[model samples]
Target: MSLGDEHGFGSESGDRRSDDSFGGSGQTRTRLPGGGDTDVYGGARRPVRNSRSLITVVGVVVLLIAAIAFANQGGGEEGPSGDGAKGTGSQPTAATGVKPVTGKNGQIPTGYAKDEQGAQSAAANYAVALGSDGMFKSATRRDIVQTVHDPAVTDGLLSDLDKAYSADFLANVGLTGDGSAPAGLTFVSRTVPVGTKTTSFAGDKATVEVWCTGLVGLAGPKSTKPVTETWFTITQNLKWVGNDWKIGSSSQKEGPTPVNGDNRASSADEIAGAVQGYGGFTYAR
Candidate 1:
């Protein structure tokens, strides 16, 4: 029962910022010390829960149970990267054969490594996966929901991500009913990590910061979705469970993002066509 799941759904927002209930500056939404409901933050009014603060507490219990089940199911998959290694106390070993993805949950198993480098690599890749265009499709979304997320957190996160990437949002991105681009157009939504850092780590818990640059828009004539780029930071509060790191909670904020470079902006049609034709990569450290 991750705190996220206990809440029922990610906090509702009034705008794009609202969709990111965890980051924007608003009143704090807190689950009560006991089971109940209450509103903690706001811009537009949303129902609030003041339930037992034990929501996250309970979610952890559920997570512990799920992890055990997951481990028992397959003895837990080993970290997909290198054997834990230490160097001149400098950068970490870049493990080969890193599976950016495995099962559908979108959980990056790379984080449970025995060392820091492994964690960093895992965190960066996980962030990219979470923010990728794959999040838009229903099938992939199901896989992501099952594979990457903690079971306790899955219910809530799935609901939120669903709303955040709803049909209306797909239309906003100039996609058809299933998030597919119309003929002669392309759709893009990807996060490119600039760097990653561990802000804090303890036992199986870590806070990893992923500095990323992303592009999101539809490229096509008469498309309203412009191929625009933005910078943001994704901070994931991860926990080591079932032999890998799983996001307990996550947040995103507008970045220390730099000014636009001299890169010429492409027309909607050009950008859309390229997006339709080109493919995104599985990012790594």
Candidate 2:
């Protein structure tokens, strides 16, 4: 089963971030590997966790993404404007569509075809990378932004992202200055792409939308900020750089959010166990 199902989340997926735990979306949260539940990039004491499904402080994680453009800024559904030829577009949520490529440069995927399908695959993979908990760390965040973003905007975008993930931002999300959870709590922040559609593909520029859902917050028996899910759509502007696709920019909007279901919310132990039981994947069309 997908990690989402192993946890309490059902199939399908957010912001491109919200603190609210959406019931049906497939977003799952994870804790950074360290130690007050956060590792010292801190200014306040953390709440204790005893594990009874506390819903309070769930919204505390929103600031981590809201400050980033990927969470607050977004465009309409219109494709790119130009004179390039356009296809009817492929099915985004289908189990299989685009052919998968097998390779990676560093940790990110590489070698996508130069067609509409490639754009969709690239967008999906990038959405996963951008929405991962790695963004909370300086070293990993730089690697992500630098590798996925076009060279022209890499420096500036990195600077912006650095500023966005400030110590204050980390603290707000229950993370310490170094981006780790407390002694026992696990901080979860993950994004799951439900579908991908290339809205515009002309020349080396393509715009793709990744409909996704995510989860963020603290998970522990006595924790008040239980991990919660969120829904959001990521609209990305990709540029064919070097021999592969790179993101020029991207923004997120709330979502074509799904209705919350009657599925039972699991205990903190279940959520944390689920995280440790699995690893992430290389998402494709």
Candidate 3:
């Protein structure tokens, strides 16, 4: 799962020209239309509003006004602004009036402490849920996507993710074509966020980078996919939505991993047995 040819197998490539699908059919099939032929503003000049044209100038002014109004609204709720821009979740806040942790609709934890530490904790935990094995399944994938991602990006992200988890993609992970467990076997894929750093914070919009270690493989008799560990970094631009941190956008990159010494590799059976026998941890700050 983690060891793959393409980095953005299930992720939406930032390139607007690429056909990046979210969760439509899976990674192997179904390519969603992006900023290529289907993209409306893929041409040169970046489709800027022209000041020479009255209509274009008016449109540009309107957009600027709208953005200002939105930022003002966000700033009001956050009380005050710090070094960075408003509406980003980067500004430091007093812990006063902040409540203890609360679970998200009986699932995730929400309403983190109004301080730097709390935000970091929230980012780490949310990253884990976003990068878990449940993302491969349709039903659980929907829940995790809806819960973790910002609402604005949900539609596009869901579409792209659908294509990322296609039958072929699942097969590559050693699961059945439909992303199910094979008879007498178990599949494992999980992400553990080791730490988090805030890159930018304004209001509810904050960009956090999660240093992570992932475990992925198949555990069962006759299973050739051995569970393996990988180090990577996941960056999430999150927005505070409905009292919880929701991911507005996310991207992954290969790690600052350490070099490995020549070590004896475990047998396939041993790997399978360990994967099936051991459960993952509930990561937190």
Candidate 4:
């Protein structure tokens, strides 16, 4: 079943974080980190000889560097620095450097800025909210859809998701008809976005991709299912809705997943304990 949630959702007109329309060649170049590079000394280098002059120049350069660093201590990211900063999907990259979203609707993040970096932040945080355990319940799921999705598609989305999470589906996932974990077991579902990039953006609309790693399944020694990890990518269609970015729609696919590492897998009790002990974070760009 497509679930319609993955690949089916998109932008109302604008929420942008890209060339794969933000459009064009798809390739991008950045000035470089810390903004750019410059010749501090502003002069050509000499071959071999002047020890005294070299020492004086080095001392001056060091002092200038220290001063510059001190002056730059508190500045925040202006926006997406370039394509590389957001990542290319094949490897890790630095953050888009956009600040975290400032407002939230209940527990769901809200009030995103109207900019590329803002779109990226919206996409990432929305992914987190959607992947949360709340999506499994009737009331909480309704609350989440209303908060993250554009009002135009909200009703249809609710209907589709209700069918998707039907009784049979709940049984398969080990959740009760009401979406509760069986007594003595912990049902865990969490999403952590690894990175985000724009596939297309035109101010009022944006298509962003979020790469994520998640935990799901039941956690308990006697339970038939034990929580496991999953990797997937969510392609979000975003639009500037009211004052914030909201999902037009979304779809999903398998992975840009990494190979499993050598760390030993935890016992079910340990997994359940960990889930109950640790709290999740609110995502940002």
RMSD of 4: 21.4
lDDT per residue (tens digit) for residues 74-125 in model 4: 0101111111222322221223665565567766668877887788888887
> Against the true structure, whose lDDT is highest?
2
Which scores higher on lDDT, 1 or 4?
Answer: 4
Clashes of 2: 28
Candidate 1 global TM-score: 0.61
lDDT of each: 0.42, 0.50, 0.42, 0.49
Worst 10 residues of 1 by lDDT: 68-77
The regions of model 3 sitting more than 4 angstroms off are 1-100, 105-107, 261-264, 267-278
Please give the lDDT score at residue 56 for candidate 3.
Answer: 10
Model 4 score (lDDT): 0.49
Candidate 1 per-residue C-alpha lDDT over 232-266 given as tens digits, one digit per residue, 9 for 90 to 100: 45566677777777767655544454643333345
The weakest ten consecutive residues by lDDT in model 4 span 17-26
The residue ranges of model 1 lying beyond 4 angstroms of the native Cα positions read: 1-112, 268-279
Q: How many clashes show up per model? A: 32, 28, 36, 20
* TM-score computed on alpha carbons, candidate 3: 0.62
Best by TM-score: 2
lDDT of 1: 0.42
